[model samples]
Each structure stands twice: as structure tokens, then as C-alpha cells.
Target: MVQARIGERLGLAPATVSEGVKRLVTEGYVEIRGARDVELTEKGHLIAEALVRRHRLAERMLTDILGMAWHLCHEQAEDWEKVMTPEVEEAILAKLEGEPTCPHGNPIPGTSSGIPWSSLEPVAALDAGAGGVLTRLLEDVELDHDVLKFLEEHGLMPGSHLTVMDTAPDGTILLEVQRAGTNPARVALGRNLADNLWVLPAL
Candidate 1:
């Protein structure tokens, strides 16, 4: 992403983002191309994977064990991940009991998750009458608590089934959401919201 956008998301100033990027470049963790395209190097990718793994694990613990709301787990996990030692991480993994995904259905980097990412597509791309199982949400979805809460209210949690019932010209999608132990719900989703929700289409 561009440095300005990165800083915007991180709530950091331009100078701070530039300095951080410079340090990462110096350490060979990332490289810049074009006018301001910063991309992660192989070394940086590995480190980022590890961090995401830990963060996902923490999110699982918060939502499953601590009973925190799924919408709030991601940001809360940020603080929890910092203090977690290797041993603690292992213990938490053991407690998760072969579950490879967090509350949002995002796979932990080193786990044996069988999710077929290549076959997944956003619900927004499906037309009326298309059906699929909601699989995972994008990382950016976690950045907005309001979006998460709205999804939860509509029963859009992972593993729920979604069917596109109709579409409006204004880019609003009408979806029928089905989850275990509840009646199917008809929810209206904006294009931007549905774009971030990936699904596994039925065969």
C-alpha cells in the first residue's frame, strides 16, 4: 500500500510511517517500487505470517474462552498477542483442539486448515439465486468494528450459509442467511460490505 494509506490506517503521521518504512527497507524486510509502492520482501512475509498467526490465536481465545464478542476480538487480541510467549501460544493452540480458524474463519498461518482459498469468491460477485457458505472475512473487515457488528447482527458469521435472493440497481444485495438453530434471515448488504465477505460456492 501507499505510505499515506498505511499511515491513515495505522493512525500514524506521514513522517512516522516514512521512518518505519525506511527502517524496514534498511533491514531488508521490505522494498519500495514506483513512486511509493512498498511491498514486503520474503523475509518480511515470514515475520508477518508469524505475527498474523499469533494474532488469530489470540482472537480465538478471546471469543471462545473469554466470551468476548467476535466483533471486538480482533482489536482486543492485538494487546494480548504482545505478552504471549511461545509456551503460552502452544498451550492455547492445544486448547483450541484442532480448530484451524479464528472466530472470523481466518486460518492461522501454520495450521492444517483445509480451506480452498482459490475457490472462494466474494458474495458481491454472485448474482441472484447464487448460494454459498460464508467462509472467511478479509483482514480489513476486522479494522471496522461497526462493520463487524452489523455482520453479526445479520447472522453472517463463518460457517453460515448465504444465498443471494435479489439485487438492487444501486448495488445492494439481498441475501438469505441461514445458521444453525435459527430461522433463515433476509439481510440487505451493500456492495462494499459484501465484497469483503468471501464464500465457498456450492457444487
Candidate 2:
């Protein structure tokens, strides 16, 4: 994402985001092109992955240990992650017993779990009468609080069984969402939302 969008998501000013990115670039953590483009370097990716792993682990703890609602975990994890130490992370992992994904099914970075992420396709790719397990909420989509809550409220969360009932030309989709212990409900998803979700097809 670009600096401005990153600022928007973080509720920071563009100058503040730019300053941080500048520091990152100087530290060899990122590279910038033109006036607005920034990309993480290999060194940056390693640190980013480590932080993401901790953040996801923190989210899992909020859901699994504290019984926080699934939709609430991400924001809470944002703050909780800053307080987590390596020992704490190890403890959380022990409590989760190697469960590899966050509540939203995004994989924790360090785990050797055999999730075939490459096989997962965007929900927008499925045609009418096709279905799959909702396996992941991509990182970009997770940044939007309203959209995350909407997905959770509509039973579009990871592990829910979803079947495509119909697709309109404008890319709105009608789906039958089958979540555990809940009656199936039809949910309408707009193109933007559908394109962001990932599903693992039935073999």
C-alpha cells in the first residue's frame, strides 16, 4: 500500500507515515520509487513477518484464551502485540497447541503448518453452484474494521462453509453461508468484498 492509504488506515498524517517510511528506507528495510511507491526489502520482510507472527498469535490468544469475539480480536491484538515478549509468545503458542491460523485463518508466519495457501483462490473466482471452505481473510481486507465486522456478522468468517448460489454481472454474489451451530443464511457480497476473500475448494 502507498503512504497515503497507510496513513488513512493507521489514522496517521501522511507526513508522519512518510517520515516513518523514510527511516525504514534509510535503515535498509524498504525501497521507494517515484513519489509514492514503497516496497519492503528482504530485511524488512523478515522483521515484518516476525511482527505479524506475534500479532496473529496475540489475536489467537484473545479469541481462544480470553474468549474475545472473533471480530474483536484484530484491534485488540494490535495493542496486545506491543506488550508481547518472546516468552509470552511461546506461552501463547503452547496454549493454542500449534493451531496455525488466526481466527480469520491467516497463517501465523513461523509455523510449518501444511496449509495449501497457493491452492486457495479468491471467492470472486468461484462460479454459481460452486462452493468451498472460507479459508482466509487477506491482510489488506483485515485492515478495514467495518468490513471485518461485516464479514464476521454475516458468517463469512474462516472455517464457514460457503456455497455460491448466484453471481450478478456487476460482481455481487449471493451465497449460502453455513457456519457451525448456526442455520444457513444467504448473504449478499459486493464485488470488492468478494474479491478480497479466499476460499479452499472442495476436492
Candidate 3:
């Protein structure tokens, strides 16, 4: 992913995000080949994929079985992802009708199954009407408060359709996003919020 794009999605100040990426490089989780793009190494991919699986399953379990609100699911999933074991994850998947994606519709990476993580564009880059289901949220330790609030309020939770509607000189964006279902409501999102939303283009 591009540094600026990652920063925007994580709602992180550019420098802090850069430092974290640097540490990831030092730790061998990421490889920086040039000024613009970075890719995960094999070990990095393994860890990232595992986290992805945990995240999606947690979202599904929280929303579907536990009667949790969708906006609240991310934080809950974040905590659960840390303690989730492989066996537990498999059980959740089985209970959820073997669904491949989470409540917001982001695909869950399989632990023993093989599916590659695609490099995706952040919401900050797209023009109005450009849309895709959110597959992941970039993790930046110093993410902004406003961005997180916007995400929760607007249903830009993972698996939601993210459409870019505006962009500003300072890198702020305006977006239209919605959940999947008949007559799903569309909401506007500001740049701080948009920057933290990540997505793969729809097929």
C-alpha cells in the first residue's frame, strides 16, 4: 500500500504511520522497495491473514449471535481477535453457515485455506461514485478520534460499500457509504473518516 493512502485510512498523522511502517520493515513484517509502495513479506502475510480471519469471524459472531450493534462490533472484534484461537474460529465459521465474509461483507481469510490479500486503494483516492466493499481497516497506532467516530456513525464498518465523493487539498475526503441490503441507507463521510476506510474494488 502507498504510505499516504495507509495514513489516511488509519487516520494517522503521516509521520507516526511512517515510523510504524519503518518498524514493520525492521521487524520483517513489511518490505519497502521504493518511495511509494510497500508489500508484506511471507511472514507478514501470515500474521496479517490470521488477524484478518479473527477480525471477520469476531464481527460475525458479535453481530449475528450476540445481538451486538454493527457500529460497536469493530472494537469488540479487535479485543476478541487477540484471544481468539484457531479451533474457536472454525467453530464460529461453521455456526455462521460457512459464510466467507463478515457482517459488513469483508471476506475472512482462511487459516488453512489459501486466499491472497489483494493490494487495495484507500477511500481518499477515488472520485465520486467509485465504490467497493470495505475489506479491511488500516491499523495505525495513532489514528485520529474524529475518523473513528465517523466510521462508527456512518456504517463504514468492514464490508460496507465505500464511494468517494470529494477530495480536498489537505487530503480530506468526502464519501458515500452503505451497508448491503435492500434500501440500505447511504450516508456522507468526511475526509478524516474516509482516509481510514480501506477497500478492494468490486469485481
Candidate 4:
């Protein structure tokens, strides 16, 4: 992701993001590939994988153990991930039965069960009347607390069955969620949110 986008996601000032990126580049964690693009180096990838693994595991621990709401796990996991040691991570993994993904359906790195992106399609691309089981929320979407809360409130979590009801001229997708033992509920999602939602089409 670009520095500007990263700053937006983290709610950091532009100067802070620039300085942080510069420090990362100097430390050999990131590389500037183009005028506005940054890529992680091999060393950076390893560190990122460790952080992501711990973060996802932390989310699982929070939701599965403490019964934390799924929408709240991401923020809490941020603090947990930083303090988790390798031993702590292993303990949590064992306690959680080595779950492959976080509460939001994002895969934990090093879990050896990551899903191939090729097998999924963005919800925005689904035709009206088409339906599928929600598979995951994109990482960027997971960072948006409002979006996460909205999705959770509407029962749009992973494994939920949803159908595309209509697409408005403004690119909003009207959807109907098929909750077990209940009548379907209609919800409208904007293009940005819909684009970040991936689904496994009904077979």
C-alpha cells in the first residue's frame, strides 16, 4: 500500500507517515519501487508474517475464549499482537486448536491454510440475484471500525449466506442475508464496502 493510504488507515499525520516510511526504508524493511509505491523486503515480510500470525491468533483467542464481539477483536488484537511472544503465540494456538483464520475470516500467516484469492470474487462483481457464502473481509476493510461494526450488526460475517438483491445506479448493492431460522433481511452496501467483500458462490 502507498504511504498516503497507510496514513489514512492508521489515522496518522502525513509527516509522521513519511518519517516512519523513511525509517523503515533505512532499516531495510521496505523498498520504494515507484513514485508512489512501497513494497516489503524479504526481511520485512518475515516480520510482518509474525505480527499477522500473532494478531489473528489473538483475535481467535479473544472471540473464542473471552467471548469478545467479533467487531471488537481487531482493535484488541492490535495490543495483544505486540506483547505476544513466540511461546505465548504457541500457547494461544494450542488453546484455539490452531484455527486457520481470524474472526473476520482473514487467514493467519504460518498457519499453512491460507485461501487462494483466485478462488473468490468480490461481492461487487456478483450479479443481481446471485448469492454466495461470505468468505472474508479484505484487510483494508477490517481496518475500518465503522465498516466492521456495520457488517457485524447486519450479520455479514464469514459463513453467512447472502444474495445480491439489486444494484443501484450509484453502485450500491442491495443484499438479502439468509439467517438461519429467520426471515431474510435487506441491507444496502456501498461500492467500497462491497468491493472488499469476497464470497464463495453457491454451488
Best by lDDT: 1
In model 2, pairs of residues that clash are none
Error of 3 at 103 (Å): 0.3
Q: What lDDT, from 0 to 1, does candidate 1 have?
A: 0.90
RMSD (Cα, Å) of candidate 4? 1.8
Task: Report the lDDT tens digits of candidate 3 across residue range 45-142.
Answer: 99998987898799789988898876567767888998999999878888876445665445667533312355676676677668787766654411
Candidate 1 to truth, TM: 0.93
Candidate 2 per-residue C-alpha lDDT over 1-203 given as tens digits, one digit per residue, 9 for 90 to 100:
68988898788998899899999999999999777888999999998888888899999898999998888898889887777888999999888775568888877878875367788988899999889999988777777888888888899888899999999988899999999999999999998889888899977
* lDDT of all predictions: 0.90, 0.87, 0.71, 0.88
Best candidate, TM-score: 1
lDDT of 1 by residue, 1-203 (tens): 89999998999999999999999999999999999999999999998887888898899889878888888998999998777777878988888777569788888878877487899989999989998999999887889989889989889989899999999999999999999999999999999989999999988
Q: Comparing 1 and 4 by lDDT, which wins?
A: 1
Better of 1 and 2 by TM-score: 1
**lDDT tens digits, residues 63-140, model 4?**
998899989999899999999999988888788764568887878887765567888888999999898989889888
**Distance from true location, Cα of 61 in model 4, Å:** 0.7
Of candidates 3 and 1, the better by TM-score: 1
After superposing all C-alphas onto the true structure, candidate 2 shows an RMSD in angstroms of 2.0
lDDT of 2: 0.87
Roughly what TM-score does model 2 have, to 2 decimal places?
Answer: 0.89
lDDT agreement of model 4 with the native = 0.88
